[model samples]
Target: MHGHGYGQPVKQPPHTAWLVFLRVLFVALGILTIGFLTWAMMLRLAAVTRRSLDWGLFVAVLAADILSITLVAIEPGDEIHTTGGYVGILLLLCTLVGTIAYYLAADIRHFLLQQQAYEAQRTAPAYGYPAPAAPYGATTVPTIPTVPTAPGAPGMPSASGPHTPPPMPHARVPQPPQPPLTTPPPQRPAPARIDQVRAELDELSDYLRKQDGPEGGR
Candidate 1:
């Protein structure tokens, strides 16, 4: 070996190290993409909006990283085999779709709840009773009467003389008769079978004994 050009040293290309660096870089990028997407999906499902642009920014950054990784891998002398990168991109896409679907479902549920509340309110009874009828020859309908207490009632201010109770207010139009409350039919109790219950208890006891035996016990 010394006879041929005094044993020259072999020069290794820097491109080999660069290739290794590219591989590590792509792998890290892919892992980061997957982790970020998972976190984003969890936030979206939980309906957390404090970050405001979290969804948009997550998508943008993921897409940019994917594109950059793809371009780097495609470049000459940068032979980085990263199937993980493709998998990561797929996972990110799935997460984005899931987040959107979750939001839509939540929105629909909220809208339905609001609509039901509105309908309940619309069907609810008014706060007070209807106004009383007008007096004879009065142009306007009479206002609802305020009750004056009887003279002899406790805590009541005495009137000048013995007081007569005010006449009950009547509606101008007759109301439809209310339907009577119907009692629900009573359910008959199931007939008991002493023999059947005894048989079941016997079977359960046999199962328990078998389970407690040393050979078969857990």
Candidate 2:
């Protein structure tokens, strides 16, 4: 990070959001890694810093990513000879390996730098004068007041090891009584049956016999 100033550079605060953003960028980079590498090889090859291993690793990662992209784009069998295809595939594999190597190297470098900074802070001693001891062995120890403990106080346990918990009261919850089950009466037919018709005919025949007997008496 750079600031618009002629004075001392200010240390930027670390943002977790930036790390999340970088992760998203890295995913996007994966898709265009090889393309970026090839572009760098063509135009920005000289831009790669030769001063430090970290810079070299950075360049290598870029190159590998670009090469991987290029290799992926090349379709071996389509319009190209078998030999060319095989060569392209081999180059692609090598580029992919380089991509992985560079990525790991960059991560390791960053982690080491962070760890070094942490260690530096840890090892750095504090600069200040120490407090003088109580006037050459003339000790002055502060007295702590004694507090009386109750029989069953929170901090102090009882004389009988520990206090037992009081027994829980028994509660009988009333449940609703179940209703008795009764079978339903069968449904009768709407129309008369053959047995009902036979009973009616027998009653009619008895009535006709009674009428005949009354007529004979007359």
Candidate 3:
């Protein structure tokens, strides 16, 4: 993002040797008559943006650059007199242009996206998650698919509202039959002594006869 001049200037120490070393290394990679480094950077940019770049084109460009370099080396003379020499120069020029073009375009795209992100972050609600760690738009946010609500019961197209299950009806179960109860029979009373009863009867008869005799004599 910073490479495109579309990013805000950052405050830091005057300079760092590590940064200078990297810049020199980057220059050496391209100036040594090859765009391998550019292809590497292209891949890096793609990864940072989480977007795919022209991978096949990058490889083709690098291959062309190498072939052109080889041709130029074959004719190291100051003037090029052969057809291959001319094609080599043309291809070399094209590769250089392509390398720079891709780098700038990628850088610019990243920077623009970064600027938009910063603006979004500024306007974002306070309760939202924090932005990326890269303060200079070094990272991109990935999009996630929103989860849909669970589907309800299927209904007819002409249904007025959501389909609901009917309430369960109350059921009454039959009870098992039980055995009948049994009772004991009633008992009879005991009889008195027959001889004693007979003796009493005879005594009463004798007394009655004596009273009758006394009445006749009177």
Q: Report the number of the highest-TM-score candidate.
A: 3
C-alpha TM-score for every candidate: 0.25, 0.31, 0.38
Which residue runs does candidate 1 get wrong by more than 4 Å?
1-81, 125-218
- Candidate 3 — what's its lDDT? 0.62
Q: For candidate 2, what is the lDDT? A: 0.53
Per-residue lDDT of model 1, residues 113-201, tens digit only: 55565555456532343335668898965699757776678877666565568998886897899999999899765556766788899
RMSD of each: 47.0, 27.5, 19.9
RMSD of 2: 27.5
Alpha-carbon lDDT, every model: 0.53, 0.53, 0.62
- Arranged by TM-score with the best first, the candidates are 3, 2, 1
Query: Which whole-number lDDT from 0 to 100 does residue 146 have in model 3?
Result: 55
Candidate 3 per-residue C-alpha lDDT over 134-211 given as tens digits, one digit per residue, 9 for 90 to 100: 668567679997544445534423234455679988887888988778686675443455666778899999999999
Instruction: Name the best candidate (by lDDT).
Output: 3
